[model samples]
Target: MRLSTRYLVPLIALFACSSPTTSTPAINSSAGPAGTSVSSPSSLPELAADPREPFLAKAVASLLSEDHLLQRKIDDQVSREAFPKYLEQLDGGKLFLLKEHVAALEADIDHLDDQIEAGDLVLARRGAALLAKRREVVAKVVADVLSKPFDFTKAETLETDAEKRTYAATEDELRDRWRAVLKLQVLERVEQLEELSDALAKKKPTDEDAPARPPEEIPPTFEGKEAKARKELAVRFETRFTRWKDMEPLEPAEMFLNAVASVYDPHTQYLAPAEKENFDIQISGTLEGIGAALGEEDHFIVVRELIPGGASWQQGKLEAGDLILAVAQQGEQPVDITDMPIDKVVKLIRGPKDTTVTLTVKKPDGRVETISIKRDVIKIEASYARGAVLNLGKGHEPMGYIYLPGFYGDTRGASKAPERNATDDVRKLLEVFQKRKLNGVIIDLRGNGGGLLGHARDITGLFIETGPVVQAHAADKKVEVLEDTDPGVAYNGQVVVMVDRFSASASEILAGALQDYQRAIIVGTGPTHGKGTVQALVDLDKLRANPQAASAADSLGVLKLTIQQYFRVDGESTQWRGVVPDVVLPDPASYVDSGERSLFHSIPWSSIAPQPYKVSKHSWTAAQLAEASKKRIDSQPVFKKVEAFSKALKARRDDTVVDLKRDDWVAERKRNKAELDTLDPKLSETKPRVEVTPLEESAAEKTAPKTAGDKNVKKRIDKWREELGRDPWVEESLLVLEDMKKLK
Candidate 1:
């Protein structure tokens, strides 16, 4: 989450000049003619009164309108914008209400700010109610549609991009949309089944040199496959409905709260209790859970990804893309969750810090296994900085590489030195590098989302002797310049900082400061994730508390507010436009919709007067180096193919509509796969499917014989080491370091 706030009068003038903000709420005339069958904005039904809302309203109104560090006011213009934002938040897919329903409520659009001000949620409640109604109707309509096999030969298309779509005119039309969606799903699945059947029939090649038969299924006769797909899809829909039914009552309120929160800035949020705890866990870099981010896929709960230091990540047995079959507690029968909702499955998986849960998993290669995993409090090892000494050439040139996954601080508190922070770890690694007499060093910040700002300052201080690291301007026109107080340079060697599009917030801060100071050759993708704003989390309980007694609404969540905007020493604000690297690398994800600019209502970029700073070192002539690197890449066929693949992927991403015709749909799928295959083979090599190390297996701490947890940890280390070997990003960074060494 990245953000910012107001400050100097010039900043005020900048915002004011952009658009003339309305003082009073104004109704948008574009809603419709006044005499149309649709009623006026004021006619929307009133929300039922709740006792807690008054207190909640008082807090929200005060925060967004006045108390926010930005002091941003929710005037008529902002409110009108909220109407569409809130609608999109609820139904961006255009899956629920009809245009008539939207028109019926158009009268409410202009009046949303008033309700937000008055602590009323009539419009929000209406949207929620309509979604609920639609969900129920969709379940039934989908069931009815799936009762018969889909006509794959039918010439038709369905708009996949919901943003470009209009609401259906009636419930029947909505059901038709649902029917088409189910048909597409069924068709997609039958194709999968066809491929699976063909692969099953083919015998494995005995010769090691011979390649396996291509998975291209002989044209499916469509025989009984469509019926089987429909049946399977019907079961999946049943699970979806069950999952929808399990929706918590507070979810709508939470969504409404977020809708209001985003209006202030994207980073500012009202963290519910569970959300707050999760936030704390991320900050502390420890938690008690499976440590895997799970998602519902094809009616089965699947492991979408794993946290580096999380339990699931430690257990190398549970791989990403593996479908979770069932979950069982200790000494209990495994409950088959073929059609079970994900939340319920998660609840079963997460438990007391020291317990056991068995997960039945189906791997991508069709292997099935019941893996018992001990639920230990997982410390996110990946979140911390790890070091590797790379030998550049056969001449045995050694270079130190430290990968900071996030700007994690010593949450355990600094007793002697700084605790388990990225700064302290980097300092240790740099010390080791000095001992080894390395040629150059690479500080890889790729995919690092960022954490503590203080850590970033201290980390930057480790490189530069002393100077201003970052400058923050609050809404009250107060400028607080954060400087590197430590007058010590740990690493004076030639340096290269590696970053990517995902390097944001604190990551951007450190990279920006280094680039400005000319202390390091910033290498990798251009413009890191732009998030140069500061958020201060305030507990609602503390705000509402009296000196002696607290309010009963302490159960209400904490509010993260955008307090200030940060600027680089060079005065550039990394808000919409993040820090550009000295040497821009060819990134596969460059074409993807990413960074702060992609966010709705992100603050505009600005500049303050640049702070006075000195450059300690300058080895590489950046322009010449960048030009040389660009030529090296542009001339290569592999890089050229990658660029083409990226363009094609982005084009497919932009093309929202998908053909419903089975032949067309299948053909489109094949075309994409073929195109992807034609590109560099390494493009398909996503992440290393790795195993455990021997060190993790030597678990002397546990008295019991080889437990699943111990074995899992060992397997994970093997994968981690293997990943380090195959990582092309790391390879590129080393090459950049070599380039830096040659520069004079």
Candidate 2:
């Protein structure tokens, strides 16, 4: 609950197009008052259609200009940069807009800043209208192109990278581009079907667990497969178009405002009301809803996964893969949701706690049924900390492993103290490990992107005595050192903090602090994700200066603004260049072009005066442990295959042009699969190197299920343990821990 009201550290980034402002001004009428009228492009409609839009635009501009960390002005240069980004947001694939349409849209690009300042979104409207028109045209083109059979023998290539291509010159050229795209999609689907068919044919009757393909379900020939692919593509396109057309008015506004906000930095974004709600859920790891994660599949809102203890899970009838056809409040008519946007569908299904909502669903086997369930608080268990004991054969000492997906805390809790949080959970796990007398602990933060910043500092304090955890540099050049004043340590044992390229923000803070204090050895494939800045959600409704705008304040949404950049206690900012781990592992994921450095307009890495802090006493040095690890890793066959696969993957990523010819495409896919098959099986099918079991007390709770929801929870935990037992990274860490004990 520390510094809960201060700032939020999130893992997201943006470009500068504006002149620097000499001074930061308070939110006022510098951009003009609400409902301000100014000259705009003659072709575009007036802003009076949506009275709230002008006020929203003015508020966002004022906030960005006055409070953004960059303090950049909204000017012509920013407009020039933001316009193209806005265009990209509309059609990043470059599939819909023609060259002429793009030219027309770019006509007033330079004047977008002026339009925004005056509360007239002429360019945004034009771009949105053009995109709508292009989508209608593209839909027809897709239908026409798919109506005819493709010439599979014709040799051709398609540039899959949109950045490498330009807008089509004419309608014919656009149609031709669509033809290539459709052809490629159909080709991939046909090849996939063929591969599945081959696998099924090769499967022996003795293979009882193998999935059985009904005789009617299998496409007998290549022609039949191709036909099936085409039909699927048609349905997919129709669904996609319907979804796009159904987008709310505020969505386009959000995109334009985000483009403007991103000009200052990547993390600054204008979140629509719905997006703000989703972000809150992500940080808190809880929501009031049906508890089913939904995804779109050819127009159907298919339930992807059911959250354990959620309303859907408790209901028992609703399940993963079930199609939600309609939703209704209790005693109300069910509203058909075919081809509806996922967000809208979610909104309908999510309601107040104890409220009964009904769902009309189509089961996987095609049975239709109506289900009613009372909504409840759904806690996302995956986001919390989980612990397991690792038994490494007979010679090595048992070690404890804690997997923290994020630094989650209850956002709705009181600012001074949270009822439940990650720090408390991790502390409990550490206490359990302390009692067991575990030799070493592994804090697995592999894919943790970060959440609440307070938890990061408090979690770091759990491993060390009181000290400065991180330094925050605000926009006004003021520095605030966030320290752990808690005088005692939670667990002062040998520790290894596991990270990866995706470990970001709060993750970086904890890892960097631990590494700086020499309290833990860092282990990862590469540097952590370099997101050093902190963002805070500012409700635009509160910043309305004009009394006229107050009536519409509720719909104004929120702006996630970057307000501070944090640095490690060692003085180095983990902005672009993240914390370097002590022991670097050979991982194929390392080959990915990721992290903050890969992002555009990310803040550069810098250093501040290092804070005075005592380093914890450690018996073994990182170099000694790393040297021993490298020897074993080099000779490991799995790692060798990983190295080769990494190279192949890098090569594959570099080659953006794909062959459209059926035979050539199939051959390319085969070659790619052959390369992957070498390493994929080794990574997934390796025998468990260590025995992973739950904590003694939690074992009963995990295995003994009292309800259907608890049964699902048990299955997930067992699967997690099984996967962890087979993980090479975890195995490597166990070996490293043994080295730490012996090398001393």
Candidate 3:
């Protein structure tokens, strides 16, 4: 829980955005009342007709702002060393309030923009002041977040009016108790700077070689040396803050509105008009670009996957694993877009059809090259599919593995019954597993970015007999329990749920429920994503159409706000802590930064009422799980090799930059490869040729399954089977399940 200045700060930078280009408007109005008091939606700015897109856009923009971006960068530099304590002081309730404020502000901006576009300057200025007021609120909250110290005594948080009063009182008490913690951090840093100066001031060589005192034990002196050291430390903070201030300025209303929406949940956000339109276009499969999905990877703009028929893929020069280093339009110089936000990069990359864009790509092998491609529509078929299975190693021990990448179904078509959704797909997989008499089932929820909430609950029901799956807390502090109501327990024998850093939101809920019930063994990287919050899609357009503020763009318009927080049965928060695994595994993803700690304005870990149920003790306790993992780590050569590889990578991460000397870089890489080859020779082999066995019908049970054709249902099923068969994580999960069996 101790914060480290050196290792913690840079990682957070990955999530924070640069500063704004324009000056934020100052608030002349008196500040809103500080204590817990909910403002009526009618009293806020108008929401747009389709607000989710705008909210998402604006949220992304705000997250990329200078203050947030710098903080995240610093966090990453420290590799989560300081995060626990850093998150402790955050106000969960205030977080919701802030997000609501942001959403309202975004609505105002959206309205003013609409008015301006329609030649209404009078309305635009009115929107302008609301923007100013919103900024003031945001600035204060940001300051508060940085200044506050965490209180461990506030165990249960308020989600209702009475609870808020109690919660506020508890926080006040804890805040007073822990105020010294913040002061101590500053005192400690200053002490370190002073000690270093003292060492320098000593003239004797032997004295210089003397052991330095730990940061805390050094006494504060009144000498000029102490004064100089303090001044130097101040310079450091100034430099860090200046780096934050250099980024782009968000339009006044945008920052205020998005910050408000974020308080509800990390995912709920305000979108600028441009960002909203682009996201819609992307969802409709109409984006013109290289045809790849992108997201923040540490501080880099990484390509998540490629559309098979997209311009980038068709050219075949670019692969799914390549990282985009820079992007340049036809007439502009190539901009070094490394560490830039995904949406901004997307904006730069996307354009009209046939427009040429040049990209600098970096391969996993460290080879760098440039490619020029024309923009075009690309279908993203690989992101989601059906028929994934769990393999019990090479023997096909009949453990079903299903990968639900996202809860996806085209809800657009009128005749499309939503019943044929992710849950349905899973039910079919279960049926197949049951018929095959599978020994157990492994659900690979790893890398699922989340989608429909209903699908997630239904999916949990497939494994658990029945129970309350998750509890959601809204603005009024009312708790709504989402239950797993399905009576059918399909292939419930020996379930193992595999999750990693990217398994989030709905995925976290499902994993948490299964773990809470001991219905499944949760195994994977250290923790699942800590996104235990919900979002309400507010329509800013609708708000603007109201007569009360018809001309007040600032008052009547924008935001998709987050209005709730969620809790697990144990009353432990998943906001920043995430769900810890029963058995931990090594993953390449651990080498890169991801998850809640990597995001800006993420809600701090807090808890609510526990579900009226108890977790069944795991067949093996935490100690036993750890011992078994140790045995496996020592016995399995592959595991050891991966660990060693990680250590070497971490050493590299310790370096700030790399030399581009071709021969030297090549030699170093060669040496590293040789070392890796010795550890796990299989890693050097070509990508494994994954041959999926076609669904077999025993000659004894010759029943032909019904097929729905032209809909591509059968084809989709086959493709899913192929993907599941090839999944390495699924294979790894089966290994862990076998380990669990032995330990039991």
TM-score of each: 0.78, 0.78, 0.56
| Residue 90 in model 1: lDDT | 65
lDDT string, candidate 2, 1-744, tens digits: 112232233222101111122121111112222212222334322222245678888878877887777777899999988887787776777888777667666778888788888887766665665566567778988998898788999999999778889988777888899999899878866765776577667786556323234435658988888888888678767877776765445665677887777677877878765465455444443335877666655446777556555777666778765788777776564566766756678789888987888887875433355677888766455445788999878877799999987787777536665444788888888988888888789999987878889999999999988999999987677889999999878786789999988789999999999999999999999999899998777665555555235432245666787878999999999998998999999866644666888765677788889999999886889889899999999988878877887777677777889898888877876777776676553654778888998763352124222443443556567767878888888899988888886755
Candidates 1 and 3: which is better by lDDT? 1
Evaluate residue 281 in candidate 3 and report its C-alpha lDDT on the 0 to 100 scale: 42
Residue 203 local lDDT, model 3? 40
**Candidate 2 regions off by >4 Å?**
1-49, 192-228, 273-383, 410-420, 545-554, 698-708, 711-714
Q: Model 3, 1-744: lDDT tens per residue?
A: 111223222322212222222233332333353322224323443212221234333333333231231223212322122222112212222321243433433343324223222332222222334333333443443345334333323332222111132222233443432232223323333444554557645645444233333333344553433344344334443443333333222233343344433432356555443344334443333235777666544446666655544667555577545688777787454565654545677789988877778887765544455667778655343343334334444554545566566775545457855334677666777778778776666777777767778877888888766678888775456788888776677665677888888788878888888888887778887888787766443333333224244222222123344556778766666777788888787775455556788776577887777877645444756556556665665775556667777666555444423323334434565686676556542442424333444333322113223333223334444644554554554555676666666656
lDDT of 1 by residue, 11-36 (tens): 21111111111121112233233212
Please give the ranking of all candidate structures by lDDT, highest first, separated by commas: 2, 1, 3
- Judged by lDDT against the true structure, how good is candidate 1? 0.67
| CA RMSD of all predictions | 9.5, 9.5, 18.5
